[model samples]
Target: MSASTPFVKMNGAGNDFVVVNALERAFTPDAGQVRALADRQTGEGFDQLIAIEPSTTADAFMRVWNADGGAVETCGNALRCVGWMLLQASGSDKVVIDTLGGPTTARRAGPDRITVDMGPPRLDWREIPLAEEMDTRGIELQVGPIDAPVIYTPGAVSMGNPHVVFFTDRLDDAFVTGSGSLIEHHPLFPEGVNVGFAHVLAPDRIRLRVWERGAGLTKACGTGACAALVAASRRGLTGRRAVMVVDGGELDIDWDEASGHVFMTGPVEVERTGTLSL
Candidate 1:
């Protein structure tokens, strides 16, 4: 932390972040510092902390830290929020962001709306990097009574990060929190996983809740929504496109069959902007 460093508080739907531009300044926050900032009761709490650094390959490089002080590979909502901000500042219709996941492109759609090209979904068992090879469409896992499982046969996908989606008739609260927590740290997922509970409302609409890997439950999870659409499509539960309704807001997801890429469109808002003392 600098004596005084600038930051912007922004949110995509309800997932909030504190973004810092570290292009010209050194702003690497350790675990403790990140934890302090994310403590909702004591500090400027946020779901994640983002650092924007100069990039040689793309418009900028994004570094992210989860609320629990752990770093993550990608965050779709953060990308969209930052992408829109950068696009507005540069007057560019498109911006490329380089992340640990890969280089992703963001395009202007409408007023305060951005569409992110999240690339293709990684469906291979090895790509999800499970402890061992297994069918990703429906991994061999179960919850509840062995005789009659409450949640079983979840689909796994990686949208730059790991996720496991359980398509149920309803978004059961207990299931989302209990089963989600247990499966998030399950040994099968060596890298851990975001747990998603989705209920199909129609062929093109679905309601979803996510227990994020390092952040626990959040208002929304862009990557989780993308993963849900892919997982649903894989299981033949839904078409390639759908609207994912989360707690905060709605997101449009399209899994293009032609290019095999997933595109997510949503709105972003700047909550506040100020300087913080590190």
Candidate 2:
């Protein structure tokens, strides 16, 4: 690692992260190394690790890794975090971030508020990396008790990241705790899964909680908000655009009709910055 390279610590809602750039600096963070660094007990840990690199097509490339050190695609919060950092560093308000899944656009809506064009949601089974082919609209998934199910027929959507959504009568921990574990480890999802339990309110608002794949239950998840909107829209549960209230904060989401893309708007907070040595 370089002696004088700068890094940033940022968060979207409450999903905190530690971000560094490989393009501007020089550091290929190994999974073991990343895991070690993000371990709160051992180092300056965080929920996720965001690495920014140079992109041939877009303004930059973004690589996302869970606290467990597994690299994944599309982080709504991380994208906004990157956008905020880019704007602060480059004085530009618009950015395109290329990831392992695809490229996404982030535009600053206002000071501390950023909006991300998260591309389209994939409903197909293969796109979600399900182990077997199944209907994406409503899959025959059940958990908890057989007769009295905790979750049934979850609506699946991929916001670059995999999310399995369960629409509930209300938002509570009972449902989130019972069903989240089963579906996340279900035979179908090869890459594991992020689980969301949503309760619709007035068709224009939703109450949501997320069990992130590797990060466990976080206060909020940006991709989870995007996935919930996609799932609700497909199930005829809500309109294309609505506000989601998570345990940490709120996010505004819109599923575009023409382009079939999902957009998430929220705030990114920078807490502090520091460094650690292995």
Candidate 3:
């Protein structure tokens, strides 16, 4: 490995990332390397590491690694951040990005803002890939006493990534961290899951926090917010479109009734540009 790699630090709704241009230099860091870069105390520090590589179909291919060095299938906030970068570089309003999940298109919504067509939310049991067959709208899962559970019958959805959302009136940090950690590795989800605690504030608004599968807690989680909206809507707790307020900021999520695709709109910030001594 060379020690002359360059990278850009960027964020979308405060979900920070370290982005590298693998298309130019062809650098692919392994799990250990990714962990070193993602460590907040000893490394460059980011919620995720993004590699922008060449793609045969789309404008570019995006590879994502969580802070724990686990590669994930998709990341909505990263997609928006990458879209903004590619748009700035190519001087185009739209770009198609290829991911392990599938292809998605992004367009400029405003100055420094992006709108990504995240596609449909997978609501089927086989799609979320639970360990057993069950209804995704409210799966057979609960925490606390059997008779009166603290969180029960939560919903599951996959926006190219699996997520389990629990609707509640409280947004306790301890509950989110502890319960999220448990459900993230629970047996019901064979592939593990991103656990989200959503507090519905109104029919068109929700407050959310997420413990990412391999990233732990984060300032913002784009797909988590999207999943929150879908789960809330399916349960009639909220409308199909709503504003998701995360710890870092807010995002507008809309699950189109006609198309079944979800659209996420948010802002991206460029923190700094620097080179990494790999």
Candidate 4:
């Protein structure tokens, strides 16, 4: 018999994950293994796979893999889930998490809620890493036709990963899943992009739907919510703070004016626990 590893199934809002404690037992799954594990019918179904590893500079290091078996720089919802785990283990109010993006800090906001300081939003075209130098506030991209495009002039921002937010008057599922998938593979974005469809209800509230780079459409995206707030604020569509209403639940997002750091607060839920044969 092969060895098996203990796993925890967790979700932040509706963004689900299969978490492995690499700190307890060192294990890294290859792309094939990741794909097999991500299979909804055959294995543990999840939007992402998170590995909690030991870190010297922070409480723990979070490694992320999208459902498509691709490694990513960061994931806001996953961060919150990992933060909750670390806080519970250490019995601390706050903890720092290290990732490929950088070091991030998370604090206890309330019961079953965590607030993560996602550092600063990368607004430069180079940082967002577009194919060419263009204004990130409103990139020249459109869907449909050139005369009257379906969605155009999207604001680009990087919350450790590439994203583009298109402000629209209405939020539609067909549009999000269809057009979003097209934009995610646009040539302008060299490394692909997470596409956000945002409808600003008020200066302090926004309704958002995200088509993640490798995860398809998810219930909620933590970094997607943060990027929408920042992009909207930059475009004067909303204030620096807003409540992002997603498919699963709501997230409170605040972009500090002074420090320019974005904070995301949301709830985390533990779904189940099991072991995966390796």
Candidate 5:
């Protein structure tokens, strides 16, 4: 390691991550390097890594990496971290940042909390890119004992990523941890998927826990919230507007009945700032 890398550690609804700035120098960290950085004990520790680089669009170009060193198109929490950085950088309340998935706009709502418009949701089976095409809405997927009797149908939605949400009778704490990974990498999801176990508590509220693709388990996933709301709505379990409770915290989710798109509103919290040594 030549020098310690300056970085920001943040989390949105408990999806912890480290944001790295690549503008000054490049480390070209491999999977092992990324793992070291994401180590909960020894490394900087995070679920994912966000590298900010010089960009032709907006203020910067952001690259996303799972703790496993795989690339992902979008990350909602990192967007707010970027927004936080942008607010400090440009002295503005809002910023437009481009992602490989698409462009994202975020606004500083409170001290360190931010609200991000995660763009529109993609609901096509082809978009979710399931191995087989079927109705993404209220589709059948099986894993463990849940089967059709337990989870029945789930809504498949993509926010530049794939998600499968089970609107069950209750938020099974055990299943969320035990069965989540089984569903996330199911053969049905060719590119793999983020798995959510959701239980509708009321007309506009639900509880959730997620298993994220490539990153294994995390505190929360913003795109997972959007997908859960959409899935619940399709199953007639909840209204278009709902609040999803995640391990990290809470996220307000709304699926526009008219537009067929889902919107997720949440907060991003910057825990600390530090420099990574290689």
Candidate 6:
């Protein structure tokens, strides 16, 4: 292992990341290494660690690791940051990024802004892969009590990753963390799930908070935002397009009616460049 490696710290809508160009350095971090780097107090803290690798089918391959050192499928925010980096390097307007989920296209929308075609939402219960068959529009999961649950009938969707969204009028921290943590490990989700607490302000706007499966609560979750919108639309709570207001910032999410593809547009910020002692 190398003593040190260069890294680029970036964020998209406040979902921060530590990006290592494996295409340049050829580095892979094991679970322990990833956990070390995820330490906020002692190491370079980030919601996720992105390794940029070579891909034959796409412009590049993105490997994602959550703060808990779990290797996940896709990360929408990281894709935007990586897309911006690749676009700046190649000076191209569009780029295709391959992930564990599948291939996605990203295009330059404006200064520091990128729009990613995040493919279509997986609607089937088998796709979301719950423990058993059920309706994804509103699952049977509930919090609090069976007769009078605090939150019930959450919608499920897989945006490259598993998520269950609970629509409510309250957006308090306690409800989000408490209920979210409980649902993330629910037996229904065999692979675990990201839990989203969505408060719909209008047909086109929602305030959301997410408890990421492997990363706990984060400031922003790009895929979570997409999942929330899709879930809301399926439940007829909102239309296909909305502005998702997260703790870190806002994301514009549009589920295309023609293509059935979800497009997420957000801003990416280069926080800093540094070296990590591994």
- Winner on TM-score (3 vs 5): 3
Q: What is the Cα-based TM-score of model 6?
A: 0.98
What tens digits encode model 5's per-residue C-alpha lDDT throughout 69-155?
A: 788888876777777787788897777888888887777777767777776788888998888878988677765476345565677
**Clashing pairs in model 5, backbone N/Cα/C closer than 3 A:** 5-276
| lDDT (C-alpha) at residue 223 in model 4 | 94
Residue 37, candidate 2: how far off, in angstroms?
Answer: 2.0
TM-score of 4: 0.98
Candidate 5 segments exceeding 4 Å error: 145-149, 169-174, 256-261
lDDT of 3 by residue, 1-278 (tens): 58868899999988999999998678778899899988889899999999999999999999999998899998999999999989999998899999998999999999999999999999999999899999999999998999999999999999999999998876787888889898999999999999989999999999899999999889899999999999999999998999999988999999998998999999999999998776
RMSD of 5: 2.3
The local lDDT score (0 to 100) that residue 68 gets in candidate 3 is 88
lDDT of 6 at 251: 98
Q: How many collisions per candidate?
A: 0, 1, 0, 0, 1, 0
Q: TM-score of every model?
A: 0.98, 0.94, 0.98, 0.98, 0.90, 0.98
Model 5 clash tally, residue pairs: 1
Q: Which lDDT tens digits does candidate 2 get at residues 1-278?
A: 65444567888988889888778675667788888878889767688988899989998899898888888886888898998777677777688889987998889898799999999888889888678888887887877578997668888888888888888864567657657766778878888999999889868899999988877777789989999988998889999999999887899999999998888999999988876454
* Residue 169 C-alpha lDDT in model 3: 72
Local distance difference test, each candidate: 0.92, 0.84, 0.93, 0.94, 0.79, 0.94
For model 1, how does the per-residue alpha-carbon lDDT over 1-278 read when each residue is reduced to its tens digit? Answer: 56888999999989999999998997988899889889999879999999998999999999999998999999999999989988988998999999998989999989989999999999999998799889999999888899999988889999999999988875667667887889989999999999999999888999999999888889999999999999998878899999999999999999998999999999899999988777
lDDT of 4: 0.94
Total backbone collisions, model 4: 0
Cα shift from native, residue 37, model 5 (Å) = 1.5
